[model samples]
Target chain A: MKISLFATCLSDAFFPRVSEAMARLLARYGIRLTFPEGQTCCGQPAFNSGYWVEAKEAARRLIDAFRDSDYVIAPSGSCISMIHHHYPALFRDDPAELRMARELAEKSYEFSQFLVGVLGVSDVGARFPHRVTYHPSCHGSRLLGVKDEPLTLLSHVRDLDFVPLPFAEDCCGFGGTFAVKMADISAAMVTEKADHVRETEAEVLVGLDMGCLMNIGGRMRHRGQAVRVMHLAELLYEGVRMADERA
Target chain B: MSGHNPTSTLAERVRIALNNDFLRNAVRFTTERLRTNKQAAAEQIGNWEEWRERGRQIRLHTIAHLDYYLAQFAENLRRAGGYVHFASTAEEAVAITLQIMAAKQAKSVVKSKSMVSEEVHINQALEEQGIETVETDLGEYIIQLAGETPSHIIIPAIHKNKAQVAELFSEVAGEPLPADTAVLAAFARSKLRGKFLEADIGMTGCNFAIAESGSIVLFSNEGNARMVSTVPRTQITMMGMERILPSWEDLEVMATLLPRSATGQKLTVYMSAINGPRRTADGDGPDELHVIIIDNGRSRQLGDPEFQEVLNCIRCGACLNACPVYRHIGGHAYGWVYSGPIGAVLTPVLNEEKEKWAEVANASTLCGACYEACPVKIPLHDMLVYIRRRNVEEGRTKRTERLGMKTYKVAVSSHRFYQLALKLGRIGQKPLVRDGQIPTRLGPLKGWNNVRTAPALAERSFRESWQALERELQQEMAEMSPQVKARLEELAGKRGDRHEQ
Candidate 1:
């Protein structure tokens, strides 16, 4: 499968290794990944911040960039959800843009969703033995409906202890630009999430989206906690070796 | 009627609320508890999404044909020995309510948790007419005593902790009382029981009005709605015109969705369906029942494609729980009787005051959690965006903010402009940069940077880095595995076939 990887701007800049892991994992699944250079942001940051015109322009760039790709995959569920779900609505007035946007929306998938739903694989045979809890990103859970795929893959990891976090569905408060704009409220909300993570008795917290993980990780570091955070792709990639060795 | 306090804006009120530590803590605790309870109940229900869609369909159908259903409901209500009045404005609503008060020669009135009454400021109007009105809901009673408006829709005095409630209750009791829940509730129960029985008129909000049966349904855990409906000799119900459904089958969907969405309950302790005034054979219910259906600015939203769906809100605080903004600031920060996502949309649209409400829309993160949490699927985030867009279109935005957005639009629309802007930004931000961070204490950035320092632009842009990666990707795609490629082709074929169908 030829897949265009929209390694969301955030991951590309701050967490480049996540993209590296994503590329390797897709390759293992026999999916050839293409990085469409013309892609910028998913226009979510500006769009969410109420800069609709700017967001639309950015969306235009993105739509044109990967308009002909067989499949567009992103490691971040939130960003993938943005393109698949939000782009069509963002370009509702323009018929031409709307058509392309809808096509892109249909073709785009979150990494785990692509793996489990499209690839039809329950176990990518990833193994990470750390006790970890997952924070399902709000957009991915509710918008994208990537509910149990991440967790299902996580649960399959051999010898890994998966602890359930309390209020697992509650938002982690990293609402794109909302964190910078409403820091006080964001801090309070993330504090509650951090508290819940502390109570889960898990050594690490793993999430599908890097944005949420980064937000939670930053707070964890700020509070001087040693709990590690990693993306689901990285964990699944780790398990592939185990499955191969066992075979 | 109480005049608008020219001293403060909604933003100013929210500012005061944000500063009030006790109010914040109390509101947070109560909402969190209610949210938790709601979650547990939804889990217990088993097929929550199916139930949610059922509720959404009913609300959508009813609201789309609001005039037809409301007219049918009013006609049936009148036939059932009830008086129906239509109020086009809040003043009209108050006028009709006050006319009922005068006709009854009522000196005192008691109310349950009707948001319409608060919206109309009926209590202040009645008080101005030298008629005493009391709030019977315990939470509302406390806030009423405190001389304040309700901060939350469901839990009216959510901003007041038990200590604050005890203080307010003690003043009403003419004796000091403990902050214990049981003790406080007992005192309120006894105190309000007197008002319930003695008041000449009772008023309440309609949760949903059944069009087929001419009945009004209310859900309440505390039984105050029931008390307000049954106790007074004369009862008045204020309903939003859009609060109608086709039949009892739809009511079942509402019954399942409302309480569960609002407070995470399988059902409230009491769910009452009042058809009309008490019949000659009945032992209870009011002798004279009057329902004042208020449009107040809702009619303006009738044909509004971008906003009409907002009318489908069940006033379930699930949106509030799921709203990141509401969870932090609490309800009072909304600065109206209604708070949370619904409040942000409703306040401006209801009042037709875009200038004041434009700020309320800004309070949202537009995360769409409210839409997810909505049992009726109101699409509140989309509505919030629409409100902001309307605000901008109306030129209600501040000059600086408008100019900034215009500049942003220009720069982003053109590649040359965008690259130049980023370069200029990196250079322009040098003075503000202290330790590679833009610490601006001026402009709108002040509101943000006042709390947390902004991160400086990275050394290399992601757009720049993707070019090399793109070259590497083309080479890899050339050597793709045929097995996966075949699978992709099959899936594409299926999708194409489905589209053709």
Candidate 2:
């Protein structure tokens, strides 16, 4: 399919490889991938921070950027939810803005949602011999209503042992600006999440969003923990393609 | 800043809380333990979501027909010889309560944990009237002794460590006490049991007031709620207007959801449904039962679309456990009776000063974990945004923010202005850029970048890079497999239709 990638500002600056891996994997599935450059952010920071006007402006830019795309797929569940669920509310009183928001919401999909729902492929003939646990990002699990798609795909991976992380649905406290704004509380929350990870005795931890993975990964690093964090896309991209083709 | 001010900003109060290193640590330990227990319990339940949904539906139904259920509840309570009073405001509620205290000639009172009482600052009012009021809930008692408000709903003294608690208890015991849960609990039980027995009045918060039976339900892990309800000659129950459920059938769903969501228990140590004061035939119940239903600004949201669902909250503290904001700063930072996602919405919506409470809404990532954790399925994230929108709509945002938004609104409405702004931004950000990241923690970026650097604008924006790659793919496809190209078009067409549909 002609997939317009909203690499999300986080991926653009820090995790470009997640964006690259997504492109290659979808391309291998014979999908035409396009990038719409007019995008900057989904305007979540402003929106979440009570800056409605700034958020509306950002949302307008995002909608305009992907207006012509066949499918607007974002790697982050939180941001995609912002577009799909919240953007419409931002323009609740204005029919024109509301209409534009509805279109964007219809087009937007999280990376995993796009892969599992739109593409309808649970198995990519991938193999990974390791024990891993998954942390379902709050937005994806609750807001976006993606409960088992990621698990459905993961369970199909060959030779992989999936140990369920206790308190897997509990937030790891990477609340965008919330980490810094409430540093002590955030640190404590992540500590509990880290403990849960340790309890699982899994060598690998996988999640959908890089923001959460980064926060949990950073804390894991601080504690000198050996558990490695990987995005679900990277795992699927691993054995689905030849070594050199994998991002 | 306003009438009867507490002599400190909410931020200042939180600062005091934060400085108490002991408080911070204790809160961390308690919340961590509670969160873990909740997870384990949910895991054991298996069909946790279904139960949550059923719980949510019951609440939704009850709240939707609140007037009908409340009337039924009050009628049933009255029929059972319970006196039911509805207070339209905090002042009216306090007046009614004080009137009852006077009529009973109450000298001493014992209380169970009640967020509604906290909202009314009932103890402060009672103390001013020369009445000795004792908080019986272990956590509430600790905070009451410390002369501080509760920092958490479930664990009121969650902010105090064992040593601090021992110190507080020692002062009352006239001797040194050990910093042990068992020892402290025993001391508290002994001390509070006397107060419960001697007190003229017993006060408790109603978790749910069943409409059909005219009963007030209390879900407590500790037995104090029951003790307070049974021992005193007179029982006074305080409940928010939203605390109504239609029937005992719905109570089954609530019984399932409340304990599991709150502390992840299959059942609390005690879940009592008191129909009225002690019956003529019953031996150990309160002789006189009085229920005070307080609106206290809750009635303002009765028919409002954006906020009506907030009334469905069961005070289970599940949202607080799931909230990233509360997970970080704890409850005091919220600066109000409620905290976490529910608090963020409630503090402002319920408070008269919209400006003072508006900042609480900014404390979320809008990630919606609270919605997931909520047994009643309140869309707190969405409500947070609505609160923000109202702040802007009412012209409460700062001047700088207002101006910035004006410029943003103008620049983003069209591609022409947007392209110019982007080109300008790329050049403008150059001076602020350092080490492939925007290091300027100034203006709007201050709040975000205070802890993490803003990643610099990508060397090539994703949109720019994708266009170049797509162009290359188009040419390469002309020389590539036709079957693959056809499949690509077919899938793309299907996706497009889905988007349209």
Candidate 3:
């Protein structure tokens, strides 16, 4: 079965390290994850903003790019959510594309889901020593039902102090264009979320989705916080590196 | 902005709500408590998903055969000696209500908390005809005293504090009242009790109307819904046409989900299931009953696949309490009878003023909190997107957003333009990046940068480095265990079977 990496636009453009960490970490299991460069985005920005035609334009490319891949892995659950939930609806008028979209949706998995769920590798034989709190991205947990996979992965990290972030289930107000359109309300929400993050007092703040991490981490930066904001993949990869050095 | 002047733009409405510290704190504190309690309650209920699914199935089944059920309901209600009036619009509903009041010679009307009544502007119509109408539900009473609409579906006065309630009560009492909860409750209880005893007619909103028994169910913590349906000589119920359950068994499922989702109660303090007006053998029931089944744009959703499930909402306010946006801005920012996520979707669609109410749909982060919290799982996040799609399709979206989306289409239509855009973004942000962050509050970044810094684009896009990364990983490839391989194939096989179904 061909497995392709769907490095979401955010993961692709701004946080390539997350994709690198994800690829590097998965390789420990001998799984060769392929990258289909023809993929640009899952079209969530336009889709959520109400431009279905534009969203469909982007979706069509994605459908074409990964047509032959047996399984698809995306770092961001929000993009995976779009592929699983909206792609079929977006391409309902075209039978061939719709069938492909359905198959793609069935096979696509968020990174942690691909790890803990598919591979059944929670520990990944990694160790990290730091105070870490997780902000479960809203789309990842709520929309995609990716509740336990991340937690299951986190529980296996050696010496990883997992303090829960307060109101961690709450959105970071980064609804793609929502941050731009409803600025003040989004600001207030992110401020509250940042305050909760500060309350955790953890050395590292980790999450699953880059879009949300950007929103919350951006607020932390705006507040002059030095708390490290890393994706779970990066943290796991670093932990594996630490484990290797200690060994 | 549930009560804000309709002319105010969503930004202006959001500005007002955000700026008011008192309103913000009150809304946030109350919703936090309600949300926490609801979480605990859902956990205690064990098998919350099963209950949610049951409620969803009941509603879906009823709505699918709504025409049959509605006709059966009218016939059953008529057989029970209850007068059923069908009103296709708000105006017609209001006219029917006025006609009932006129026929009964109703000089005064006492009402329980009724969202449908608020939707129809019932008090205004009654007051214009020189009929005295008083709200008996504590929250509704406070809102009535202030001459404002309810900001919340469950907690109508969620935005008000004790001091505000005391101040509102002080004017009614003709004396200064202390800002104490018990004292205010005593004042309202005494004041509303008199109205209930003296009023000629009682008005209520139906929570669920049972078709088989020809009964209307009322769920209330305040016990005022009981009084409104009882004490008065005449009773008038304003039922949203969509509020119907096929039987008492379905009601049992609804009863399980509504209160737990609303306020964390297993059951409301008073769960009154009234089967028509009264029998001669009944001692303290209304002499006459008028059930006004108001369509008022509800039937518009009946045939619509996108919006039909919105009718499945049990008016529990779970979405309001769970919504991060509603928690910050309060209900008035929505500027409608309904507020929060439900308000965001319905205010535009129900009003059929998609162009006018377009911005209401923009207020959410599409987080799916509302859907997760909904008793029947309405998929409000998806609906919000659909509402936005409708707006965009009708050209109701902003010019800038339209242009931005158009540009996005061109950018992501293929990888070449996408690569160039990434390169341009990196180059463009070089001047803006301070310590690897764009802290500038200028141009399009103004809204975002006002509260958060922005990130500089990666030096190398993922695709740019994909070839090298693939080459690097090839050598390090470990042998996969056959068991792991089999498990993955089995999972994939199961997924394939699901798609065929």
Candidate 4:
């Protein structure tokens, strides 16, 4: 399977390791990966900040970048959701572009959804021994209905102890530009989320999207906590390496 | 406290709410309890989505043909010997209310928790005219005694704790009252009972007006609304024009959604449906009934596609309970009669002063939880976004934020610009980076870094390292086991064939 990676701008700029892990994990599964160099941002920050014209420009660029890919997958649920749910609405005024956007939306999938739903694979031959908890991103769980896919995949990992996150459905307050714009409210929310994470006493916090992890992890770091944050792809890749070494 | 002062910005009000630890805990506890009960009630009813859809359809059909339904309601009301008056503005509604009060020589009025009265400032208007007005609902009575506006819609005094309620009630009781719930409620019930008997006129907000029968429905737990509608000789009901439902059958859906969403009850303790005033043979009901249908900016949304659904709201407060921002800041931060997610949209749309009310729209995370929690399925999150976009198009946004968004747009549209900007950011962030996190509160990072540290930019971006990684991957894939490679190729070929079919 040829999968075009939509490494979100955040992953590309701040967390390149996430994209690397995604590539390694997919390659281990015998899926060839391609990167469309023309991709940049998903235009969520602009669109969510009420800059429709600017968001449209970014959307058009992304639409053009992955026009030919048979399958487009992204490690970030938020960016993938921006394409799968919001892109068609953005291009409603242009008929040809709207049709293309709709088609692209049908083929685009978040990382776990692509792995679990499209590939029909749950156990990716990975192993992990530490306790872990998953934070379901708002877009992933609510918008894209990617509920249980990440959990299903995680539950299959050998020796992985999964604890449920309390109040897991609540947003982490990393609402694109909302974090900076409404910093006070965002801080209060992330503080509550961090508290929940601490209650679970999970050594590592895993999430499908990097934006939420970055926000929660950054807060956890500032509070001088030792809990580590890892993307699901990175965790899965690490598990695969562990399994491979044990073999 | 009586109404939104409009003197402070939404940010300033939010800061005040944030600083109040007691208010935060009170709001959080009450909202959490309400949210849990609502979830259980929804589950108990089974097929909640179907009920929600039916409620949405009923509201859409009524609001779309509001003219016909409202006319039918007025005709039926008049046939029942009730007077229906149309008020186009707040002042007009107040004037109509005062006229009815004067004709009946009403000196004292008892109100039963009407948001429309708050919207029109009827109590203030009446008080200024030397008429005594009292709030009958326990929560409203507490806030009224404290001279504060309602913070939450369903629970008017949601920001007040038991201790605060005791203090407020003590002032009214002319004695120190204990903070016990039973003591406070008893004090209020007894005090309001006296006012209900002495008041010459009763005023209540219409929850849902049944168009076919011309009956006005009021949903309350305390039965004070029933008292207000029955004890006075003359009655006045203030209704937003969009509150009409076509028939009692439609009321079934609203009845299912409203109470469950508001208080999580199977039904409000008292669901009173009164048609006009008391007939000649009736006992313990109002002698004269007057219904005032107030437009008050609601007509502006009649044909508006973006905000017309906002009227479908049943004032359930489910959105408020579900909103994280509201849980933190409480209802006072919204600085209006309506608060929470609904207030974020309704305040701006219902008020003609968009320049000021538009600030309310900025007080949301656009998390869409409110949309998920809505009983009528009003797309409140989408409406909030539209409100923000309208504000920006109207040039109401801050210049700094506007310029920042523009720069972001230009940088994010091109990979070259985006990578260069990231590279620049990496260099610029060096002085601020400590332990792989930016901890300095400076410039744009001040607000963010104040509460949470930011991750430092990667030492090498993905794009810069991609070519080398690609070469390494090519070498690794070339040495892969033939069996695995053949199996993957065959699977890809099968997927391609399936796609072609």
TM-score, prediction 3: 0.97
TM-score order, best first, reads: 3, 4, 1, 2
For candidate 3, the docking band is: high
Q: Residue by residue across B1-501, what tens digits does model 3's lDDT show?
A: 136578888899899999999999999999999989898999998999999999999999999998888898989988988999999989999999999998888899999888998889899999999999999999999988898889999999999999999999999999999999999999999988889999999999999999988888999988999999999989999999889999999999998899999999888899998888889899788988889999888999988989999988889999999999999999998987899999998898889666778889999999999999999999999999999898888888778888888889999998999999998888888887777788999999999988889998888888899889889889888787898889878987897788778
- What is the lDDT, from 0 to 100, of the residue A221 in candidate 2? 60
Question: Could you report the DockQ of all the candidates, in the order they appear?
Answer: 0.31, 0.31, 0.87, 0.54
lDDT (tens digit, per residue) of candidate 4 on A82-189: 887778767878999897787678678899988887667799889999999999998888778889889999999999989999988888888877888788888989
lDDT of 1 by residue, B1-501 (tens): 011232366556555666778877776787778777877888899898888888878777888888899889989999999999999999999999888888999998888888878888888899999988898888788888888887777877777788888888888889999999999999999988888889999999998899998999998888988889998999999988888888999888888888888887777799999999999898799999999999888889988888888888888788887776786677766766678889888877887666766677777766677887788888887787677767766777677766766676666555566656767877777777676556666875664454444556655554555566556654654344666567788987776776587
**Which pairs clash (backbone N, Cα, C closer than 3 Å) in model 3?**
B1-B332, B1-B333, B1-B334, B1-B335, B2-B332, B2-B335, B2-B336
Candidate 4's TM-score on the B chain:
0.94
lDDT of 4 by residue, B103-212 (tens): 88889999998998899999999999999999999888888888889999899899889998888778877899999999888888887778998999999999999999
Candidate 2 vs candidate 3, lDDT winner: 3
Better candidate by TM-score, 1 or 3: 3
Stretches of candidate 2 exceeding 4 Å from the true structure: A7-21, A36-41, A51-68, A91-103, A121-136, A146-242, A245-247, B1-7, B13-20, B429-434, B438-451, B475-501
* Residue B433 C-alpha lDDT in model 3: 79
> Would you estimate the TM-scores of all the predictions?
0.90, 0.86, 0.97, 0.96
Q: DockQ for the candidate 1 complex?
A: 0.31
Per-candidate Cα RMSD to the true structure, in Å, reads: 3.6, 4.5, 1.7, 2.6
lDDT of 4: 0.87
Which candidate should be chosen as best, given DockQ against the real structure? 3
Tens-place lDDT per residue, model 2, B1-501, is 111234455556555555666656666677777777888888898988888788878877777888998999999999999999999887888899999999999999999989999899889889999999999999989888888777677877776788989999999999999999899999999998889889999999999888989999998888999999999999999999999988888888888888888887889899888988887788789999999999988988888989998998988898887765565566777777777788888889998988777667867767677887788888888898788778878887678767766776666556457556656777878888787667566876664454445555556644446666666556534232565456546766775687577
